[model samples]
Target: SLEVPFPSSREAVIALRSLSPDREPRKGGISKQLTVSGSTLSWSADEARILRVSVNSFLDHLSLVLETMEMFGSPVSQ
Candidate 1:
């Protein structure tokens, strides 16, 4: 399990939703899970080469989400 902390719970939830859609392309032999509690995103996966690739891809998407959040402010408009 890996826990990634966000500045706010809202951001954590946003990240969770953004990252949740892309399920692993293959079935069986590999698994990935993502969830958010408070201001932290929790991730777990099966240990394998695919895990590294999946995590690297997730990190890439995560960075983009965080950067967009930084630039545009909160996702919710007042």
Candidate 2:
């Protein structure tokens, strides 16, 4: 399991949505799960290799998200 903290719950939820697949994995015995609680994201995978790949991909995407957030501004509602 991996736990990542975000600045806010909204940011964490955004990260979770961005990282999650549109549909569940088709392969059997290979599962990846992501959940957001408060300002943190928890990730779990059924295999080591899958976990590694997912983490690397998530980090890459997360960096882009953070950079975008920094470039623009927080997605706060009025």
Where is the poorest 10-residue window by lDDT in model 2? 21-30
Q: Which predicted model would earn the best lDDT?
A: 1
Query: What lDDT does the true structure give each of the candidates?
Result: 0.81, 0.78
**lDDT tens string, model 1, 1-78?**
678999888889988998888766566653767889899998877665555776777788889988989998776844
Cα TM-score of candidate 2: 0.77
Per-residue accuracy of model 2 over 1-78 as CA lDDT, tens digit each: 888889899988887887676525656754877899999998877677777866776777778977887888888774
For residue 31, what is the lDDT in candidate 1?
73
Global Cα lDDT for candidate 2: 0.78
C-alpha TM-scores of all predictions: 0.80, 0.77
Worst 10-residue stretch by lDDT in candidate 1? 23-32
Clashes of each: 0, 0
Off by over 4 Å in 2: 22-24
Note the residue pairs that clash in candidate 2: none
